[model samples]
Target: MDLPTTLAEKIAALSDGPGCYIYKDAAGIEIYVGKAKNLRRRVASYFQARDGHPAKTLRLVQETVDLQVIATDSEVEALLLENVLIKELQPRFNIKLKDDKTYPLLAITREAFPRVFCTRDRDQPEVDFFGPFGSAKELYRAYHFLMRVFRFRVCDLDLREDDPGRRSFKPCLNFHIKRCSAPCTTRVSQADYGEDIRALRAFIGGRNKGTVVSSLRERMKRAAGELRFEDAARCRDQIQAIDRLKERGRLRDYDEPAAPTIDIHAGMERLQAHLGLAAPPRVIEGFDIAHLQGTHVVASLVQFVSGVPNKDAYRRFKIRGEAGDGDPGNDDFAAMR
Candidate 1:
């Protein structure tokens, strides 16, 4: 379809920064909302040939008659705003994302030996919930990994620090396998158990991660110094595992601030000057590949305005069967093409 003169003008006027864009139909009703790092690039893509576009996208482009944009300071801010707008507008083409209820949260219950488990409920105010993870299997993998490394209790034995008889209780299978700290039999003291839980909390929060790792390193050195090779080896293994997980970017800190407070305009000016561009890159678009091994691959396009993410302009595409090799997987170059 040929671009309408009015729509073409709007596209040409789009700023090259991070922000969200809304698509409206002929009746002036919103049809789609998307975020982009570069508004001009992302919005312009819709008007381009529909050869590789998704069926839904093609249809959306055909129906769009107007565009609306909202610029933000940071990508994280844009994401938060986009989520809000999507929920409020419920545009026809926008995919409904799962909220907190659909995902499981890793919670630490308020008890003497706090029970850590995956839960759907936020029933108790005292209980700390770490996440509402999208993938339960992946979440469990992380949880189990932490359990093995930290040896925190998993069972609900109602054991308390004040209970004198707790020491006589038999250890469970997890305890025997060294997967648990054996709180039921008091093999690990309350102080030590609390320390482990605190460390675990720090790790989950994504704050003080370096501190936790540094502590582990120190412990490893001390263990080796005492000629406790087994303990030292265990520390080394745990450290390596933690580092691997960090490298994979599996751990996310939802509570962490998106970015420090800074002069966004100044940053843009500096970037402009450094790149020697005609104008500051106020709006930008980003692309990433998502996959489970080589299967179920997809591509995501994100928009940013003034270096802030615009979640509303975000777009996702399922890799077409023909785009992949004989085996299904992520083909980043092919997807980009």
Candidate 2:
């Protein structure tokens, strides 16, 4: 590929609209994928020798093999297509976005007596999961608080009730530490455990929304009025649970948007007049390339669920092909297969 003599001349030649543009290197390998509101102007930016562009742009101008474009109705559509193309081809140059941390997740199994605990993977099949929690310690503190307040199980469920090897009278260490409700002791009935699990879900969801706190105080007053010291002790624990919720709220505010219907996938409307075609596919995968002085070019994929970035489903690729001379070609359309 050879450099086109004049940069402004190319801009004067482009038609304005939504589309994908390709930039190639000297050997004619595409190294970058980009979208444009106006083809000519967008393409010309790279060729502006005096524009003080970055090294990537400079390389783009020097080795750009050819120009290609695909006109679309809108920039939004162009953005959608841009993401698709870059991901498939993994063009040498593109911005990268990353999310790479595992936090404690709450998982509740589908059973007569469900268990609640922290997990990291969001892909558990039979359990409900919440969170890509920010920090393990914060999550653990929250986990332990929930366990103490909720009295749910905190030990392995694999041991059989009649397993001969199992100690008939021995309780797990966690039970001794007050982390477990000592369910293994047979002292906790299934019905009672079920009640605890329900309360826990409500607490984690932050419902009762301070109602728990108010209820506990009222109960403590009633118990004290009746001179029932044992009932008052129970109410005190509820008060502490309220305090735990307050502290956790300060870190991860549970002010989530109204939860989406798990059934409906976004962008899957059955009919739309604008498309003049079938409903657009709801699932979208966005691709991006990021480079640092052409030294490290990274490709990224962002998976969207209902037009929202589900950060848990993201991946990044390190690019090495055609990145050396700094001019990574940007043919996103070809990458779109």
Candidate 3:
């Protein structure tokens, strides 16, 4: 491909590091945002033979007039940065998450004997919602798993521990089968039940599965040392459950593995060298023009600090006058100015 001297120079300056690349059109609008293990290879690949590339890739390359690169320390950091930027920028070419709206969540009711269930809407703020998960089936499966593992209350019977009628209330099948701790009959004290709740919280609070298991194992060892057999047993069971979930591949994607550290200083220095700047640029900003068939022309300005997005500094502008006049080509420069 015959490329412009300036664009070629810019591409040549790209570093060999894990990072994200932002492609922009002639109007300085970001059309696509992508990440790569090696910035030089990945971004350069886009400009190579159009014959072998996909139709989408061809179009992207054809329209790309300018680009920005943000280097990270590793592929994991690049991946995480890519996700955050994509969600924040909502670029035109990227494959987006279908459901932009919040999904159904699993909540534990804020009651004396909390009931765990799934619901679409959050009516009460006090109750804890574990997820805004991708699907109800997944959430329910998780809920059922929790039910089997924790054996907390799932019934609606309002039998208080102190109430005289509590003695008259008969044990349900759940109690007989050992599903519930039978809190109504004081089979499980409030303190013990609260410990179960704490464990459940730790399991679901976006902590890495391995980390959770390791912590549980440590707790189990400590409990054994202190001769707390019951607590030790509970911890051991939790660890086993985690192992089972791993074996079954039922541990959902809520808990993500830890990403590698991003070398912001090195990224800034490399970017500076690539851009041929006199000094390392402390802040970088991106401008994008968005429109549908020349109507409703608008601009998005995204700011970055040392190669990372500074979301708070982002701004949007509605193009007016000549730029907004439904022209064949919108004037992004005029709008930005």
TM-score order of candidates, best first?
A: 1, 3, 2
lDDT on C-alpha atoms for all candidate structures: 0.67, 0.54, 0.65
Candidate 2 RMSD computed on C-alpha atoms after optimal superposition onto the true structure? 27.8
Q: Report the number of the highest-TM-score candidate.
A: 1
What TM-score, computed on C-alpha atoms, does each candidate reach? 0.43, 0.36, 0.42
lDDT of 3 by residue, 59-114 (tens): 88888888888876444334445655665676788753323445676678777667
Q: Between candidates 2 and 3, name the one with more favorable TM-score.
A: 3
Model 2 segments more than 4 A misplaced: 1-104, 158-168, 213-235, 244-337
Give the backbone clash total of model 1. Answer: 33
Write down the TM-score for model 3: 0.42
Between prediction 1 and prediction 3, which has the larger TM-score?
1
Off by over 4 Å in 3: 1-102, 159-170, 176-178, 208-235, 251-337
Q: Please count the clashing residue pairs in each candidate, in the order shown.
A: 33, 12, 1
lDDT (tens digit, per residue) of candidate 1 on 147-206? 666777655356788898665665644555556667766576686577668777866643
List the candidates ranked by lDDT, beginning with the highest. 1, 3, 2
Tens-place lDDT per residue, model 2, 1-337, is 4356443355567786546776656566667778776777777667655458877676656666666566654443344355456555566665441133354555777664566666676676788765444345555555545655656654334434444533443554445544455445454445545655665665554324355456567867887898877556655875775565423422233222233311122123422344565655445698986666654566889775434344667898765455344335354332232
